[model samples]
Target: MKIRILRVFAAVLLLSFALPSVAQNVRYEQQGTAYVTAEDQWIADRLVDQAIGAPQGADAQVVFYRTHDQVPGPVRVDGGAGPLALLESGTCVALRLVPGSHAFVIDGRTVTVRVEPGERDYVRITSAPTGPKVAISNALTFLRLVTGKRDPLYASN
Candidate 1:
């Protein structure tokens, strides 16, 4: 019994030290504007950087996709969650999205796509002149963009 107890203690000690590295998991999900305040954007950006291996104070990958409808029309698509990989807030989680099609609505169209971990993906905004742009904001600006209502980055003086 004493030997078994000692082995369990050693295993606990090993896990205690191993947990921090395991905490590095990334949770990726599309943040709903309704549920997220502007400040959350900063947090989201930070999480994205960490997901792509940038971690805090480092740069990461961010990409955007635009699409024009085969025929002229409003760009519309429904995009929120999918089977693709995503890193999200609340929990530092790393997992593949649910295995299936997810709808993304933007502009005025609809798109069905799959999402997974590390699969940086986006809804194709067809028939739109421009799609959402993804840019890296330094820590300060990133915070301001989230906390401030007006986009200081694009405000006209």
Candidate 2:
């Protein structure tokens, strides 16, 4: 039991250090739903467009993934216009965002994210009281899983 516990601890520790010295300086681009948001067709197809590799042109990629499995029901992700994708646990969805500040609408709250040119960012969503909360990760544990060469990452979670 001790060995198994140690292995689990090691895995979490390794994941925590995957980004090494990445400075987690998160910039929120919106405040209190006051910004215009993009309309994603998440419900029409039940999933967002999956991005396996780096984005093209001058856009940056943002991958959204859930952090926990406590929420048994699917979380509804919508845009300003209409319904978006329903997020399930353990799935990764990638979006090619233009190089600028963008707002992510979740759980009736808005989280702002700034995208840099030719850079890739990860968003980890967790359940919160009012709604789902999001944060930027400085680790590649999920990045690798999203961009894994062998397994194609889709909009599952």
Top lDDT model: 2
Task: Evaluate residue 30 in candidate 1 and report its C-alpha lDDT on the 0 to 100 scale.
Answer: 46
Per-model lDDT: 0.39, 0.59
Candidate 1 TM-score, C-alpha based:
0.23
In model 2, where do residues sit more than 4 Å from their true spots?
Answer: 1-51, 128-130, 141-157
10 residues in a row with least lDDT, candidate 1: 86-95
lDDT of 1 by residue, 1-157 (tens): 9999999999999999988656532211243343344445445555555644332222222232332234343222234643332222111122233445555444433455554433433322223245432222333343343344444432111
Candidate 1 local Cα displacement, residue 150, angstroms: 34
| Candidate 2 total steric clashes | 4
TM-score of each: 0.23, 0.52
Tens digit per residue, CA lDDT, model 2, 1-157? 9999999999999888964434321111332122211111122112222436666678887777875567676666555566556778767667777888877786676767788997667677777555677777633345344444432333221
How big is the positional error of residue 10 in model 2, measured in Å on the Cα after superposition?
A: 38
True-vs-predicted CA distance for residue 127, candidate 2, Å:
2.3
In candidate 1, stretches whose alpha carbon ends up further than 4 angstroms from where it belongs are: 1-64, 67-100, 126-157
